[model samples]
Target: MSGLNLKALRKAFGPTEIISGVDLEIADGELIVFVGPSGCGKSTLLRLIAGLESVSAGEILIGGRDVTRVDPARRGVAMVFQSYALFPHMTVRQNMGFGMRVNRVPKAEAAERLQKAAALLQLTELLDRKPAQLSGGQRQRVAIGRAIVRDPQVFLFDEPLSNLDAELRVQMRAELAALHARLGATMIYVTHDQVEAMTLADRIVVLRAGRVEQVGAPLHLYDDPDNLFVAGFLGSPRMNFLTAEVQPDGQLRPLGLDVDLPSPIAGLRPGRRVVIGCRPEHVEIGDGPLAATVKTVEQLGNSTFVHADCAGTPIAAELQERWGTRADAALRLALPTEKTQLFDAETGLRIRQ
Candidate 1:
């Protein structure tokens, strides 16, 4: 078991900074996910932790030892990539045991670890199959089993599920979670998909450009994002942003429609430009305040999404039960006052609580 502590971690490509001063503590046996949009440095940070890339600054401590400059093989960390880097000619068993064999570990001991890992990944029956013979999901399992056989202090997964189909990705996600529970080893997963980050991570690190935006439990980040970027980035279907102004009585006027705000902000001057943010699920269709016209309708059996234009403001609503929804239909929406989030229009900063 191992816990990782990062202090002022920074990475740069020449003069361009990639990871700007990130500090985080990953608990032993915890599964942490790093998520962000493209060019957000999520994968680069993972590589830095794996010793696959050099750190421009800051320290990386694993199990109380600073391994910032440690060799990849000496870091006691193993990684699984999105593309399974399996030897085409080697059978599953050989691929899983190759590292141990190269390290000159006894054949019996190597086989023992392989057997245990294969069992955990449910790849025991496919041990004799080559990469060409196994399915994508099976190949991924072999890749993970390879890492497990190493008995590393930490496991790093860099978008390992991105290459799988939607159905297989979901299946593999559950498998990875179960695998983590069985082993209780430190894990760091990096992905662009917020669904994966939300479901699999014990804690999430949301990054943008080079700096860490926020780090917390999945729900915490979703419920209380530090800035507009995080508030919009964490949810499915994404959060809706509406033009709003802070009123004289400390209320939010969304699209000229009055709505109450829970957190006190009386100091905000009247007509102060602010961005009103709320999730799709928080939007309710009713004969009230905000006005929009339905532009498209998406029916997903379990839930229906209504894409509407709120007086030129595009709004998407996720409904548990779709009773009345039509394309190009005019609709009025009531904004949830207490559940609302406000961001400064100029700086995109969340108005101080």
Candidate 2:
């Protein structure tokens, strides 16, 4: 499978820019996910790469060949949309074979390719069924099946599971991961769901507004966020943030508490305000230096999360086992120095070692 490259790609609607100068190199056969909030330019970027939207500037290259002006079909890419976009009158087998048929692939060859794709997607049994006769998951698999029959070098997906119910979405996520492994093809998926990005991406391109904010492996970004936006966006319940002041001698005074900024953050000037962030899982019930009120407790069987007020700041701390912390009570907690993350309050950049 071949990969794709975007060189300083930009898109604009009149005076407003939607995707600003993005330069990306997707490794061949890699699975990359584009994730961010709505209107962040993720889907627009995908569409740009697919040739659905023209690039306002720069070039798009697939497999090292420039294809900025080439048609999407000629660029060797297939797209799966949020809506299945299958023909109501066409059977599963016909939908999967549609592209080949359009390209004038012989009926015999198209049939052969469709058969293989349907089998891989476990849709062989439903080949005779129309879209209305299939389950949600089966219909989605059929959509993927159609893409597979094209045997394109890159598969582009734009929130393909957003239409499904919660339970089916979870199951389809797993199935799609398995499909990628089996096909060993490069796939570019766009979604606003952080969980989907974290689980499915070999690397995630986190976008904010019109440009790429950060791109890295899921855990790497989770463990070492580049800025406050990324730190806050990737994890569930999000990371906790507190206003702090840098005192003389480069010390950090978190609200209602006094402590020196750790050595990793000593570069920031003293007398500057900063933002301190820590994931809920990083905050623990131990003897450290943070405090909060137990506002509520959520027990999700395997893991428990405690939402508490830390000196007027709502903070969440995780407990491995259930704890008896009732609401409206003081709770002492620890923010393990290494586990805690700090950001420049004004710039929102992570302070690193």
Candidate 3:
């Protein structure tokens, strides 16, 4: 296994920069994920590390060696792309061993590596089948097996599960996590899916508009975001935001609510505009400060989501039990002081105490 590092990594097309200066250190055997919305430079950054794109400026290092200008093949990294990219005519065995064959690895060694990778990926029984005969998940596994046989120092996955169906995607996700644990190899994954990043990554690098926003463990970034952009992006239903005005006593009056709550941050001058953020799960629905009218109720078997309007501001709350709730129902919300987050209205930055 090998560690990877990027120093002031940048890329540009003509005068428009796609990747700003980024510096990150990925530890050996760590599964690091680059997550962001589309066109946010996540894929560009991954391609830069794979040596598929030339860096406009900055350095790329792998296993303590400067590989900024190294050829993709010599950089000791293997990439599994969004598409399976398998040869339809080639059997699973041939597709997995193709790179080894091209590199002129001895026949026995190539065969051994292919067998081991097949067994590890649970593709041993499908070796003789062509891509046409395989399921979407099986084809994806074949692509991953191809990378595994290369014995790369680092593995790069570019939305490798995006093509699978919903249920299959979940299954492949679990398989990928198990594969990472078994190999213990350095990996950098790129995906717009927050759920995939949260489940697979040892650490997540959140990016936006070609710049790094925040980097942390999944729950760390979720529970304590640095900015409003991050706070709203990582959650499933997303966090709820309400406009508020700060009072002299470090209290905030939410625009639609009657009661004032203590500000989670300190030192805000009176009348400063701020945003109050509460996650869907944290917005308790029994009885509290805020009053709302339920607009919709989503029953998800095990749990329910109450979508309500607090005067004009919309909010959602998750309940563990089925409420048999209906639209136009009256409800009260409890925004826990300890669970609330404060952000600058104009700058969209978190206000830390």
Candidate 4:
């Protein structure tokens, strides 16, 4: 429906800046996710876009119109918050149609919108039920349905599934994806859960502190991160980092193991300290130059995660097969040259070739 733009967007409380200058263009009908750790300004940014928080300095354009100072109700956007925020006394039908009623929509139009949203969210059968009678997932659906009836140009979800159980969260995630596809509405979602961002977003905007670190398709950012933080943050079990020093012949010595640099990096000089990174899946076990002591073994049913200590450096490796390996056992691990990443130790930036 509508594309959203932030030009030098910023927000501050008192003298402390919470959202720094951020510029992003979200295409019409695109589902963009803002992901980061707690207190990383993801929620602040979302609130700013919703007009719930005043912008400290910057411009917000929605559907090509400047709405930086517009009222929240007039911004053509609807928000589903972490809490359901439903009126316990109101039935699903009444709650979903409350906004329409407040806006003086025609009775017939409001009824029609309610029916359509209920049917779309599979809440048609629960219209007469109150929030107290509904399950967590059902209540969340009611909240989303309320937003849907508004027919907003953009939809903002602020960790809407965080309150649900693990199984319900997974179910709701799939349902949300389906709903997005059906409506084709522009959506901005904020979450600290990287799994949610990876599975739900058309593109992910990774944030830290109050600044955007990287914005791209999920896999793109995962495979080609621009900095060490992005690489370490996006993956489960996280990437393994080992301190190393560059040798004259493009080789690196990490933890008494010699590994050739993955690629030629510009500005890399001999004796420069660098960090070598390898994902769990890329760390081959049972055969390589690096010797480690197994610290822990996690049996995840289908796969195993081996955490080891190599000369005081911790490393984890994922194995397709179940290993009978126990703690305190010695193992050799290898870091494949093609799969390894190099980073500047001082700057925590990727050493680009």
Candidate 5:
């Protein structure tokens, strides 16, 4: 029953609006991610839900009860921030149990809660260590452990892994996913990283300019996006957009490559201009209608990324095996008819059949 519901949520800082007209529902035990570029209000929305900021309008409900005006401490949730926020002088055990101690929770209860959280987070071995003695990952674990000890109905993470190194971020992501599975507690996470959003969330809320651009399961949004912003934003290395125009026969000529539109875009007619989107992995490097000159090649052991120029538009193609093409080499590219996406040139919306 610890689900979250936002009804026409809005937030304004004095005269300027930050979060505008958002409506969403997060089911109990779901790990939902709020992802976007910096200043997109993802963090602000998380704060609004956590009761850290006053709502300009609308209502916030958690576990079926309204808590718009409730104090953050009174809400049945715990938050972990980007900063570890650990007490430098305190041991891991002490820091984890501090909240309960301040609330005058009995000594035995606090100790038990701390013990359980530490065990869950694999911090039992480091309980005696101080923040100064621990690495970034360990400090983060302590922070998360502190939140877990509270036994809140929901957990909020505000880019908790951003401070960690690349290797540690991957480790923490796996750990957090495991923790979510084990606890089955409702969680809301905010991050500007799309990879984290795709790998960590059961559903992702993509934000832009203080508004939600789209929300859905990660792959659903990746495979079939609602508009150009989402299609370009959700994928790594980004989806490619090449200039295209609808032919008199209803086929599309995208970067001089002819392809039939998907079944969903049946309404598009001749003489209309559109953008053709193809993910890097979808474009085949072989003989086809389009020709490109490789401008750069990225070799990453298991795969290769070819950056090229087709006419004037930049194109990126990914290959699973090793590629021998070097800079300035000529290559033919093919866009599979079934794998391409069409968007209206004027509105920047996916043109569906």
Candidate 6:
């Protein structure tokens, strides 16, 4: 297996930049996911590594070899695209071995490799079936099996499961995770789905508008983010942000709700404007100073989420059980003093503790 090293990677299209300077390292056998919203350049960066796109500036090193200028086929990598890209006329067995045949690999060796890949992907029985005869998940497995037969140094996936329905996506994600453990091959997957990134990545690289925002383990980024964007983007239901101001007495008032500070931040001195972030799970229904009128309540059997408006600012709280609150009802919730996160209102960057 080979690791990937990208140094100062950049790509531009006629005067417009799509990928800014990006430097990343993927360890051997590690699954690294590039996650961000659309137009964020995650897919572009993956293409650069796969040698499908040329770099405007900087270098790409695979297994310590400079492959920035190498052709896609010679870069020791195989990519699985969002589309299955399978041949409709060919059987699964033939499609999986097509790459090997084109490269002039011996027929016996190619057959053996195809057989092993089919067994690993649980597609041995489907080898005789054409693309139209297979299910969506089976077709995706065939695409992956095709890549596996290449025996590439690194694997590149560009939203390979995006076409499947929600349930199938979940099933395929688990299968891909198990496959990684079995093969121990270095893989870089790109997706706009944060849930996929959190569950599948050994480490996540968050990007925004072609530049890296933050990179860390899933929970690390969720627990402590570099800025408002990373904090709000990583979590489900999103983190809540409210405008606040630091008083002369060094007290923080967010929508008139007093919150204690953990420590003094450089830009958070007395009278500085700041934003307070609270996770829905961190809020609790209790007797507190903050009050709101319920706007909506969602009961999902095991849990409930209450959406409310406090002095025109929206706040949400998640509870283990249903609260049965009606619209326009009054409710008071307490914010965990320690769990609240503060960000500089001007720069939107977190105030490190």
lDDT (CA) for every model shown? 0.88, 0.89, 0.94, 0.93, 0.90, 0.91
Runs with alpha carbons beyond 4 Å of true place in candidate 1: 255-265
Clashing pairs for predicted structure model 4, backbone only: none
**Could you say which candidate leads in lDDT?**
3
Model 3: per-residue Cα lDDT over 241-288, one tens digit each: 999999888799988667788777778999999999999999887778
The lDDT ranking, best first, is 3, 4, 6, 5, 2, 1
- TM-score, per-candidate, Cα-based: 0.95, 0.96, 0.98, 0.97, 0.96, 0.96
Model 3, residue pairs in steric clash: none
The superposed Cα distance between candidate 1 and the true structure at residue 24, in angstroms, equals 1.2
Name the regions of candidate 2 deviating beyond 4 angstroms.
256-264
Which residue pairs in candidate 2 collide? Answer: 252-261, 292-309, 293-309
Candidate 1 C-alpha lDDT tens digits along 25-140: 99999999999999999999999999988999999999999999989898899999989999999999999999998888898899899999998888989999999999999999
Superior by TM-score: candidate 1 or candidate 4:
4
Model 6, 61-87: lDDT tens per residue? 999999999999999999999999999
For residues 126-147, could you state the per-residue lDDT of candidate 4 as single tens digits?
A: 9999999999999999999999
Q: Please identify model 4 stretches exceeding 4 Å from their true place.
A: 255-267
Instruction: Please give me the total number of clashing residue pairs in predicted model 5.
Output: 5
Model 4: lDDT of residue 217: 99
